[model samples]
Target: MEKFPQMGGELHKIFGSPESPFKTVSDNILQYTCGKRAECIELRRKLLEPKDAHLAKLLTGIPPSSTALFEERLLAEFVRAHPSTVRPKPRNPPRLPPPASVQPFPSTQPRRERDPALQVQEHKGSWHYCFPIQAQGHQEQPLTQQ
Candidate 1:
């Protein structure tokens, strides 16, 4: 389930970390020790691979890799060590001059005159204008013949 370092809780963090000591161990049969440290180093190398690193970074927000059993605790530790890089910062979408509003010509009233005088409307591939004439109250709006 919680396979990546950031996916699990404190108690579940049984994986090795990048900072874990990786000195060579004595190979003497009698003095030979476990390979956990070496495994830890290899795990770090794998996680640091550009693809895996990016994968780890992209998961939580977009989700939720690699070897199934490796403790994700190490990945979590990496995130812990470098908070900004691992976690995505919220980005402000470019402020658009609020969309050039296309308010349809009001059927009941005139649009206050602007420099353009008339508002243009695009239909299919052609342009047309709406001139609201208040005759008593309403008048038939015409579309220019194509």
Candidate 2:
């Protein structure tokens, strides 16, 4: 069957004769669909011009023409709803200083006292440390370091 002829018959049947209340819409739709198809492309461009204008506003920050019905509805919805970003802003906290009450760490190892007896005695080939001898009546006592 011939496509457009069948489509017109079907549209006419569905919408009624050409003089019906749906004239403009059905006529524009038929014009957008009819003819050598090249003409149909032009008609389609004209009919959906608002969609293209909305897309232009989306692409560039500027709107090429006055607000279209689609844009009006979308912006109205946005006004009604609380639109937020898909993801929240990133958080970067600052490094904090330590409290004044915190004190410094103590030394890891304790210091030891020196032993004087451990000093080297070179004169005697055998190493020995001598203490003063105390004179007693019959015995001698070694005086130790106080």
Candidate 3:
């Protein structure tokens, strides 16, 4: 049976359509692999001129064009493919500004320390009486007299 050209177009629309590069590539390493969005935009802007026609063709399998849509698509594909080789890393959070006004009083409450008791320790021959670390500003209370 002869395949219809219309069917081919339909297939491309349904299954072969380009997936969103954001989803295609892992979000964890997207920034590191592709750089910030502004940087990608700038790089796409530079790619419009096609300084090397051969390189552009080799990268995207399409001829370079000055059109904005072409540039965006090229960059999207480039970003999607570039990060696959490296494992994804967690995204770095944006730096926030420090508080404008300093508080008059600092925190005065003492922080609670974790339990300093040891579970098990072998000292020479005995296998018991594990010593616990002394907490600050507190005296050791006798649990029981030996």
Query: Which candidate tops lDDT?
Result: 3
TM-score for each candidate, following the candidate numbering: 0.21, 0.15, 0.19
- Global lDDT of each model? 0.49, 0.48, 0.53
Clashing pairs in 2: none
What order do candidates take by TM-score, descending? 1, 3, 2
Per-prediction count of colliding residue pairs? 3, 0, 0
What TM-score does model 2 achieve against the real structure?
0.15
- lDDT of candidate 1 over 1-146, digit per residue (tens): 44676666543433344332331222343244335645665566455444455655543322113443335765576567656655454697575443335534464356766745356677666666654554555533446656
| Superposed Cα deviation of residue 137, candidate 3 (Å) | 29
Report the lDDT tens digits of candidate 2 across residue range 121-146.
43424543443332333332233433
Please tell me which predicted candidate would have the highest TM-score against the true structure.
1
Q: lDDT of candidate 3?
A: 0.53
Candidate 3 segments exceeding 4 Å error: 1-70, 84-101, 104-146
State in Å the error of residue 98, model 2. 56
Tell me the deviation in Å of residue 40 in model 1: 25
Q: Compared to the true structure, candidate 3 yields what TM-score?
A: 0.19
Q: Rank the candidates by lDDT, best first.
A: 3, 1, 2
Stretch of 10 with least lDDT, candidate 2: 59-68
RMSD in angstroms, candidate 2?
23.8
